[model samples]
Target: MNLFLILFGKIFVFLSSFLNLGSGSTWPGHIALSINKNFLKDTLTKRKFKIILVAGTNGKTTTGKLIKEILETNNNKVFHNEAGANLINGVASSIIKNSTFFGNLNFQYAIYEVDENTLPTLLKFFSSDFIICLNLFRDQLDRYGEVNIILDKWRKAFGKLKAKTTLVLNSDDPQIASLGKKSKAKVLYFGVDEMRKTELEHASDSTYCPNCGSKLLYKRVAFSHLGDWMCESCDNKRPIPNLEKLVSYPLPGLYNRYNTNAAVLVSKSLGINQYFITRVLKKFKPAFGRQEKIYINGKTLQIFLSKNPVSFNQSLMTVKGLKGKNILIALNNKIPDGRDVSWIWDVDFERFIDSFKNIFVSGDRTYDMAVRLKYSFKNSHQKLSVFENYKEALKFGLKKINRKEVLYVLPTYSAMLDLRKILTGKSIL
Candidate 1:
């Protein structure tokens, strides 16, 4: 019966893939497999599989991809959600699609990027051997009520895990790092020691302590609220960094440094050779739209995706040091990208007031972005050009940019995909 069910599941998946339907569309296949788990228990049993789960507000995709690469470099066959389907149904689909007849997962290990809110649900399906908890930030408030809510859920779920599991946590984020204290599993942490780039003294959020009622004290801040912090009353503080040093990348920003550190720690914890980890880190390329570069018609265009205040501020900081003569920005208020659209004010656009040569704004919220730029550069030499249409905006912006000078284009999530379609003549998805 188990063999028959597995064969049926494989056939369904093969047909779905051949039909050009998304791997996520195999939900029915997963349900059928779940029903036969008991019958297939013998084939699935006696298999010691390693599992790595990554969860956070941002950087999940990049970190997950990098960790998968490092694991694969060590000759480990890893099954992962490469298509970015992180929900429960997506995980189920990936498992069913990758398994063979007789309910055997051919892969030696599994690495999944679990969504922050979906971690509790996925935890019930599979017990993770290792978990990487990245920083938490306010994102899509309509969907996720508050950062604290997610943190509380994580704490409750992690408390129920077995003691053998290992957790790799980011100490800089008070919200995320606090979860390690409750987990019965072994915990390893990574963070920056020296204070390089901290947020402004009067930044939003970062108030109230997660442990006790006392206010959290900041020794150094990286951005918004992420930094070396401690609570005086309850004695809550950032966890000690186990992977102290980090390999530097071409990407400019303190946040990228944190990301690199997190990835390095995961690689080391997985028992990967140090030599291979360093080699991969040096050769790592920025994920698409996260400082991705492209060339067209004898001109170089650098694209950076900025969806929220933290990301937008970091992207602006990255280009502030560059001697760019032309700039283009795209903003949108779509569902997946964001709906509030008011978070733009939190970004530090004042730094680019006098640096850019020409600033082009385009997207569904092009006028809103233009007004923000106008206020930022109210007394600067740079002028704002608004185009309601993305294609026209891209044409005009590219025409104004000289081939010798670099054109920096920053767009939100939806706007970035739309701009990529216009620039590359293909869909990024």
Candidate 2:
């Protein structure tokens, strides 16, 4: 039965790719799981490879890619689920595709960037060698509820982990760091040690201590709620990280520093030398829609996938650091993007409103985003433009910029995929 499922999944994936229907990242696995509830557990039961599960509100894809690349560079075979396909179906599909006809995975490592809500359920199916929880933020409230909900689920799951499992957590994130306290598994922490702001963003979540429900005090905030935090009531403070500083960072932004640090820590935990890891990281490229650059008709366009409030603010800060003059913001309220678009109001758009010369808005929720921009702009709205048609908006926005000026696009999850499809004439995963 398992063999038949693998063959069926492979055929579906091939046909999906051959016909350009879409990346068969999930459907095949969905069908496989529907047919057999224990598809994942059954297939991966006796696997020889070490499994790594990455879960968080953000940075999963980039960090997973980093680990995969570093391991491959060290001559170790590695495979990861397709980007954006982080659900159970995606996991099953990846297994089916990567495994041989007899359900064997020949890779030394299998890295999976798991969805926040799906982590506990995933753990029930199989035990991972390394479980890395990056950070938790208020994201997709409609889908995942709140940060505390995920924290509860994770803590419960962590309690069940075997001693052989290693947990790599973000020490700066109070919610994530607290998970290490009670877990039976060996825990390692990673955080950034650079200069940080004393202020927190308006949309900062998980500022309260996970131990005693006290408000977390921050000495310095990297961005949002992540930083050097401690609870005054209880003595619960940020754990001293196992790895913090790196010789060089492949990408820009303080958030990327955290992502890079997590990846470096995981690589080190795998017994990969720092010298070899550093060498591999120096040449690493940005994952798709993650500061990914595309050159079209002598113009350069870079995408920063800004889905939630904190992520959106981080993208704005990173683009500002790059001195981006032209900007496009796309907002979508699709199922994948979360039905509610109220989170945009929480983003610190006021900070970067006047920085860009041209700001174009278009998406399913274009008018909603435009309204948010209007409120942010207050008296001066001359720099803003809204187009109902995304293609028209993209064309006009590109034409507005000169050769030397790069167009920076900040988009919600679904909007990012749509914009990338239009620009690159291809679909990723």
Question: What are the lDDT figures for the candidates, one per model?
Answer: 0.75, 0.91
- For each predicted model, how many residue pairs clash, with residues at least 3 apart or on different chains? 0, 0
> What does each candidate score in C-alpha RMSD?
3.3, 1.0
lDDT (10s digit) by residue, model 2, range 1-429: 988999999999999989998879999999999999999889777889999999998999999999999999899999888988999999998988898877778999999999999999999999999999998888899997878888999999999999999999999998899997788899999999984699887888889878888888999988888899989999999999999998889998888999999999999888998778988788889998999999988999999999999899999999999999999999999988999999999999999888889999999999999999999985779999999988999999999999998999999999999999899898775
Error of 1 at 80 (Å): 1.3
For model 1, the local distance difference test gives 0.75
TM-score: which candidate is best?
Answer: 2
Cα lDDT tens digits for candidate 1, 1-429: 655655676677677666756444336435654675343234433556787888887777777777777777888898876444676645655666677765678787777787789888666655688888877777777778887888888899899888878888888877777787767899988887656654433333545677786888887777767778889898888878886566465356776777777887878877789887777777777777878888989988898888777777777777876766678899999886778787788777886656777888999999888888888875953578889999888888889987887788999888988888888887644
Could you tell me how far off, in angstroms, the CA of residue 308 lies in candidate 1 after the best superposition?
1.1
**C-alpha positional error of residue 180 in candidate 1 after TM-score superposition, expressed in Å:** 1.2
What's the alpha carbon RMSD for model 1?
3.3
Q: Model 2, residue 116: displacement in angstroms?
A: 0.2
